[model samples]
Target chain A: MSLCVLEKVSKTYTTGDLVVYALRQVDLTIDPGEFVAVMGPSGSGKTTLMNILGCLDVPSSGRYALAGKDVTAMDDDELSRMRSEHIGFIFQSFHLLPYATALENVLLPTLYLERPVDGGKSRALELLSLVGLEDRAHFRPNQLSGGQQQRVAIARALMNDPELVLADEPTGALDTTTAAGIMRLLSSLNERGKTIVVVTHDPEVAAYARRVIRMRDGVPTEQPSGRTPRPLTAHPPVTP
Target chain B: MRRFISSLHQALKAVRAFKLRAVFCIASVALGISAITVIVAATEGAYRRAYEMVDRFGPDAMLVLGGSAEARAIGRRDKTITVQDVEALRQAFPTAYLLVPMSSVREVNISYGNRRHQTRVTGTTEGYSRSWSWPVVDGRDLSEADVKGMRNVALIGAQVARELFANTDPIGKFFFVRNVAVRVVGVLEERGTTGAGHNLDDRIVMPITTAMKKLMNEKTYVNAVRIRFLDARNMGRYRQEVRAFLRQRHGLKPGQPDDFRLLSSEEIIRFLVALTGSLVIFIGITGVMALVVAGFVLANLFLLSVSERSGEIGIRRAVGARRRDILFQFLLEAIALTLVGGLLGFVLGVAAGPLLKLAADFPIYFSWKAFAAGLILSMLVGLIFGLQPARRAAAVHPIQAIRSG
Candidate 1:
């Protein structure tokens, strides 16, 4: 079964007199354990697609399903629950709460759970270690480097063990070396059987994914596979 | 439970981030709360004073003073409450234990050797101590021989003894009231001020016979009679009998106003308590007005905070915080602010007691009940006023809010 399925999704915003279409009628499917990259220039609606997939915002019109659950008609609270339970998101800015320690940010998702997650502390520590930041768990976001902060965000996203991880320009703020490291981390997470959908305008970042989708003016079209398909364990290109 | 605690933790950090503003908010709330605390303490002190007065002057004792509405209205000083009324009251209530005829002159100049002071000088019978429930702390009570012989002896109050004699034993000392040398036979125990701020200790008492025959040179009359019943339960009945008997003896007919007024210690205490109670209510209203203003300022501050932390709100929402969670975050921040203020105000209120005593010579009492009530009231103010800002924070769209920052 597909981890995420979007049928004829569309989103529109009315700014005074003109109506801006952020997403057009687009059908897409992301199967379990699939690594997909969405590549487009500015204003190409990649962020809008990531929002719809992550359940941060529902499509203006279309049926959306995540992990076999219908999310098309969900209300705000229901969407929030869906996001909490099934989706993990990494933003371009690494939106870690500045005042909170890295460990506390990783523990943020469990704060909203209906019941306590068994061994939640150990699990959060393990996730931090998975992202190679277990030693810096007590450090605040400001105390950490950009690469370290993005790693903390990745750990926080995986705290709830979501079905799919969504990244919208996750390394947009990092240097080239740091960005390459983050893409390698994403590739490693995908190798470990975690589904990932990353939105990026950088072709080199898209090279890390097995498949790529191109969007133009809110319309998305799939590119032919195997152009720059690298093995999961292959080293990312060393971009100075 | 965990979620609530986490939210509280978040609120604490937010408050810590803006320490100055948080302190300002707490101070405003503390000022409002301090006003209420001061009022509560003042009224408590007044209540204690009233209780002391009622205790000192036995609750059942009645003071038949020299003035009547008609006498005062007609500008007549005919000695309405005299020794004749005392005799009639004694005859009417033969079971009465004490019927002390009394008179007083305010601000009489008294001198002991070189020291001189102006104080109240009361003239009453040998039953003065029994009727007023005040015991002589030193020396002996006046004898019947002293009254019959109209001896020039006096009992000084604690304050009068302190001022006139200082460390010297006042018993057997001579003090001249308006140049008439009177020997101090005893010293009364220290009693604090009255509810009306009358210094209870700053006075001296002399025998009515000596006062009428020698001091004032007035005979066959007294200013008032203070009566104490053997069985206090029938005081009302005996009081009425005394009034009727006095009216008959004074040749007063039906529809004629009697030339005396009956005052009870309990009535005086009640009047004082009611007066202080009204003052407390007035002070309380002003305090509440101040709290309302503080609440508005607190709400405005929370609104500003919400706007500043919109990005944080969005991040929490994206991490799975519901609108209610966001609402609770802001609400808890407000409550936390007010609770701190309430605590500080309670401390200020309690501390104000001694300051009031020193500044105005007023007594103050602090009760934990008042402190707890003030705290609860302050928190309620936070909750009520915090609703609008919390709702505003919760209503922010996660996508847009997260993007803006």
Candidate 2:
């Protein structure tokens, strides 16, 4: 079964007299273990599409099934629960709490969960080690480099073991080499059967996914890669 | 429990970040609470002092003073309280233990040889000594002959004797008051202040007959009469009986109001407690208003905080925080701020009690109830004022907030 399904989804905003369509007539589905990239220029609605899929924003008019649940019918609290349970987000700016250590930020989601997740601390440490930041677990976000911060964000995204990872320009603030390193890490995560959706305007960033969906004027066109997306061969290994 | 701790942790970090603002808020609240505590302490001290006075005077002690409804209506002060009234009261309450009619001349000039001083001169019967628990320490008290013969023998207070005669023996010393020769027969024991800072030992006691017939040449008048019941248990009944008898003797018809006022030591204590009670309550209300204003300032500060941390709030929302979670987080932050402020206020208030006593001789009582009230009020004010900002913080759209940042 598809992990996410969108049927004729549309979102519109009325600013005074003019109506702006952020997303329009979108039909999409992602099966388990799929890695998809949404690419578009600024104002092309790629972020809006990612937001809808992540359950951060509901479509103005559409039917949305997230993990086979009717997401379109959910209220704010229900949407929050869906986001907490099934979706993990990686933002472009690497939004780590400035005052909190890397490890604490990773454990933040579990702290807000309805039921206590047993062994949450160990799971957070394991995710940090997965991202090769276990040694820097005690370092605050401001103390870490851009690459390390993005790595911590990646670890946090995986903290809940969500069904889908929505990364919105995850490496947008990083240098080329660091971006390549992040892509390699995401590729490994995808290889481990985590369904990952990356939203980016950069072609090089989108090249890491098996399938690319290009958005223009709130609509999408699918372009299936002929072969598996290549990970950077020059990047360091996953294990430190 | 974990969530609560996490939220508390986040709030502490926020408070630390805005250290100056937090300090100012706490200080403002502390000032208000301290004021409340000081008033409570002072009033409690006054109440205790009044109670002590009542105990000293004994429960059966009663007074009939000059200023009554009929006296005020008649607009005559000199003859309002008369010897006749005292005689009538004694006749009515024939079994009374002791009754004394007393009057005073304020700021009278009295000279002993070269040393001259101005002081209060009280005139009364010999019953004044026993009725008020004042005893002569040197020489002898006045006899019945002193009053009947209208003699000029005087009982001087310790303070008056010390000021006038210095080391010279006061007994048998002659003093000229109103240019009339008066012999000091006794020196009364020292009585301290009246607790209201009035000197109790700065007086000269003389027989009422001398004061009325010789010095001032006034007759048939006394300022007030002091009475002690023989049986203490009959005090309430005697108090009512005296009032009724006096009203009849003065020919005051029903509803015409009493020509004289009857008071007991108990009534005086109750009056004083009520007076101080209302004053303390007024001051308490003012302090509470100050606290409410502080709460408003706190709420305003938190609202500014919410606005400043909108990006962080949005981030939390995206990461799975429900609206209620955000609300709870901010509410907890407010409560934590106020409770800590309350604690600081309580400490400051407790400290101020001794300082106030040192500075102004004001008494302070620090009860657990006042401490708890100040703290609980702090929390309650925080919750009331912090609600609007917390709700605003919770209502932000994650997508819009993220984009705005």
- Summarize candidate 2's per-residue lDDT along A1-240 as a digit string, tens digits: 889988889999899999999888788888888788998888889999998899998899988899999999889989998888899888888878777889988987886676777898889889999999989999999899999999998998898889999998888889999999999999999999999999998888888888888888988877654455454232222110
Off by over 4 Å in 1: A10-25, A41-45, A216-218, A225-227, A230-240, B67-79, B88-99, B104-123, B135-207, B228-286
Q: Which ten residues in a row have the lowest lDDT in candidate 1 chain B?
A: B78-87
Top-scoring candidate (TM-score): 1
Interface RMSD of each: 1.3, 1.4
User: For model 2 chain A, where is the 10-residue window of minimal lDDT?
Assistant: A231-240
Question: What's the number of clashes in each of the models?
Answer: 0, 1
DockQ of predictions, in order shown: 0.52, 0.50
Tell me the chain A TM-score of model 2: 0.93
Please report the candidate that would top DockQ against the real structure. Answer: 1
